[model samples]
Target: MSNEKITIAKRIAKELKDGDVVNLGIGLPTLVANYLPDDVDIVIHSENGILGVDAAPDKSLVDKDLVNAGGSHVSTKHGACFFDSSISFGIIRGGHVDVAVLGALQVDKNGNLASHKVPGKMIPGMGGAMDLATGAKRIIIATLHTNNGSPKILNELTLPVTAINVVKTIVTEKAVIEVTPEGLLLKEIAADTTVEEVQSLTEAPLIVSPDLKSFDVAA
Candidate 1:
């Protein structure tokens, strides 16, 4: 994985608290599982009918039938359970999940998310994302600051929206942003990144947090 992706994953991992039940979306969101602190105890839920997700297993230990939402082979934490998708989604739609970390194609200033569709690009289909977006108590976005130099954070969404006004926080390689009723707030910036660099890559105006601090992966 690229450093940018690892940085974003590690930053999002810090948001996971003890006793939290988190559903991780495919791609970068799945990487958050690897960075979760050793002291933190939380259940990792995969929509594909597994809970208590553990780290990726050694190749020799890989279980073909045991995979995450991204279809990557993974180990299970002690006491993990399995069920049908119906029951898994029931846990999600029932608002039992504490947090949902998702990826986005675009997230507008209003916290609207666009992740499933990319215009004419063929997609398998919107999977459990729509349900997770609305079902989770807290929604966090983990994505690149830009896509091929184009800002993913925008004043208005140009792609199909996954859920409107659902995202609470966004973690990118350059910064950590919070979406509030007022607007987007730049809460933290990467140690190597400058505030101006982050602003230049973001289409939406940012309100820099008074308590803004440099992002450290070790923290």
Candidate 2:
């Protein structure tokens, strides 16, 4: 991954609280595990039926047979356990997950998610995205500011949605935007960027935080 992408993952990691049961969606969201704080002790749950997941293993130590929901190679923590998909979905549906970190294609001002499908492309099934988005106590969207110069955050969604009004926080490479009842709030800008730059790149109108600050985080 690039430095910006890694930085995005790092910023998302800060949102995780101790003892929170977090379900990380596929793609960039999967990288958050690599930068978790030493003091935080969130349990990583993979929808593919494993709990107590550890950080991404070194390439040499990765076990091909041990993977996350996205089919990415992963390592298990000391007490990691595995089970069938039915039980995995059961845990998710039972409201056992605290926070879910998901990647996005488009998120609207109203906090609706559209990560599953776009206009013209093939994809695997939704892969528990709906369940996680609805079941988790909180939902955080982790993504870059834009896709190939086009904004992914918008005033309204253009693609098919994954879930509606479920996102609580959005951590992108350029800014930390919170999806609130009033509107999408710009909480923090990146260290190297300005609020103007962030707004210029975003399609949705932003409600600037009263205590707005620049991101001081390190990847």
Model 2 lDDT-worst window of ten: 116-125
lDDT of 1 by residue, 104-161 (tens): 9999999999989976785757899899998999999999999999999999999888
For candidate 1, the C-alpha RMSD (Å) to the true structure equals 1.6
Clashing residue pairs for model 1: none
- lDDT against the true structure, per candidate, is 0.92, 0.89
lDDT of 1 at 215: 90
Mark the regions of model 1 whose C-alpha exceeds 4 Å error after superposition.
none
Model 2 agreement with the true structure over 1-219: per-residue lDDT tens digits:
988889899999888898889998877888897788999988999998998987668999988789888677878888889989999999888889999999888999999998887656846568799899878888899988899889999999998888889999999989999998899999999999998999999999999999998885772
Runs of candidate 2 with Cα error greater than 4 angstroms are 56-65
- Per-candidate total of colliding backbone pairs: 0, 0
What are the candidates' C-alpha RMSDs?
1.6, 1.9
